[model samples]
Target: MSKVVLITGGSSGIGKSVGEYLTEKGFVVYGTSRNPENYKEGKFPILELDVKNIETIKQTVKTILDSEGRLDVVVNNAGAGITGAIEEIPEAEIKANFDTNFFGPINVIKAVLPQMRKQHGGLIINITSIAGYMGLPYRGIYSASKGALELLTEAFRMELKDFNIKMTNIAPGDFATNIAAGRYHAPLLDNSPYKKPYGNTLNLMNTHVDNGSDPNMMAQAVLKVINTKNPKGHYKVGEFMQKFSIVLKRILPDRVYEKILMKHYKL
Candidate 1:
């Protein structure tokens, strides 16, 4: 039988791309959106899902298990971007970001573990960010959320090792998507301390995203990962410089790495 796959935030962007790609490859793919109506024309079945809602996650996973008998892979890909200086962002907003980007996947992972363990093998791929590796100016919270997710992914893998379940964190640098449009801007006032750099950093971030690699490439990376019996714990996807940044952080001193990031953002 073909493998069954579930991907969150699949209405558009990387989620949609990955869902379509997997469907084409003969995987029984179920892509999810907050509202299924908006994605009625999606290439794969668009299930109504809100990662922040634990109940919805459970129901959806249950539905899949009931129909498919087994679910082999789950791509936790639904999350939004937040742009602004740390202080300028509101507490509520930060919590919301974490809920969707970090806790959402955790809930899903918890919901699926039973099915995966019963099936005796499964793969969980968390969609993290390249920003998760290093803190960038004006995008601190988004980075934090991804960083937290990465940690969860690692810890979960360790606990699930003997269960024959697998997990990976895919840190994507950027891709042409609606994420830039959906990015939450920090509430700033006329005399805000971060006024100058706020605009500069937001623009630069968008520019990099505009020049980011294709979402299809990211999907292809996921495809390659799923085909493997034992996938790497972490996978980086994006441009050369962005991908290399992770390497640079490992070899360079802390201050040197800081300077490189600062210079890149003109901070």
Candidate 2:
């Protein structure tokens, strides 16, 4: 029996590549996106969904379960980035980021758990970021959102162990994805308080994202997790620089690491 895996934000970037890889691996993949038709060539079934909407998520899950009979994996990959000083950001933007990154995944997980519990097995692969572990200057909003996901994954993993459900969080460094281009900036562009300080920093961050690792590699990493008999609680996937960054943070002293960050942002 082929496993059924569902991925959110599957229209592009890491999600698209993962969906493509898993489909090639013979899993019946149902990918969710606001515009599913755009990803038609990938051969996986695409379902229209916006993770922020709980009703849409529930309906999509119902459709998948009714048609497929079971789900083996759920990849919560539908999230976006928001940049700026926390204080300068609007409350609405903060909620929006959390809605998509944190609560959105929670909603999907909640909707799927009853079925997973009954099946006595399932895998949840959350697409988190290294930023979730370490905070950065202008990316506070984004960091916090992913940070919440890190804790959620841990707690859920502990709670679901008895049911034989597994949750793994992928803390990818910087993978070349469309996230930076689509990153939400403050809507109050003209009167933004952090406008002066954040201007060049945002550009610097975007440059790093633009030149980061290939999304396909991250996709392959996802496949590895899916195939593993006992997937790890977390995995870091990206270029050498990303791996180096995680290592350096662990080994370097506070001041030294601070200097490295400041130097990169030209502070």
Candidate 3:
């Protein structure tokens, strides 16, 4: 039997691309969306699920297990993006981002772990972000949420090792997707102290996403990792420089790397 796969936030963007690719490769794929009705034409079934909603997460997982009897792979791709100065960004928005990007994935994992343990084997792929490795000026909240997930996966992998369940993080750089459209942007305030710099950084961030590489690249990366027998704890997919930036952070002094980032963002 083909492996049964579940992808959160799969109605469109990276989740959609990964689901379609996995389906083509003979995997049984199901994607989730808050508004499944809007994606009636999607290639794979888009189940109703809101990452922030525990009940929906449970229902979606149960629905899949009832039909397929097993779920071999789960891609926790549901997340939200937030961009604003750390101080200026509302505390509520920050918490909301964490709910979707951090706690949400954890809830999904919890919902699926029992079934995976019963099967004695499964794979959990977390769709983290390259920004998670390092804090970006305006996208700090988004980075922190994904970074938390990355760390959580490290701990989860160790805990699930004996069950033959593998957990890994796949951090993708900017990809050409509708993420920018859905991201919450704190309004550029006329008198706020961060008005000018925040506005400029925000524009740069959107431009990067607009000119990002194809989402199919991330799908291909996901498939490759899934096929590996002993997958690494973390994998990154993106342009050379984007991936290299992570390495640079490791080798460079704190202030030096900070300078490079500041120059890049023209701050």
**Top lDDT model:** 3
lDDT of each residue in 127-170, candidate 1, tens digit only:
99999998888898998999999988888889999999999999
lDDT of each: 0.91, 0.87, 0.95
Tens digit of per-residue lDDT, candidate 2, span 65-103: 999999999999999999887887889988999999999
Question: How would you order the candidates by lDDT, starting with the best?
Answer: 3, 1, 2
Score residue 39 of candidate 1 by CA lDDT.
78
TM per prediction: 0.98, 0.94, 0.99
lDDT of 3: 0.95
The residue pairs that clash in candidate 2, if any, are none
Single out the weakest 10-residue window by summed lDDT for candidate 2.
186-195
In model 2, the Cα lDDT at residue 9 comes to 92
Candidate 3 local lDDT, 1-267, one digit each (tens) = 899999999989999999999999999999999999999987899999998999999999999999999999999999899999899888999999999999999999999999999999999999999999999999999999999999999999999999999999999999999999999999899999999999999989999999999999999999998999988999999999999999999999999999999999999
Best by TM-score: 3
Q: Once superposed on the true structure, which residue ranges of model 3 sit more than 4 Å away at CA? A: none
Q: How much does candidate 2 score in TM-score?
A: 0.94
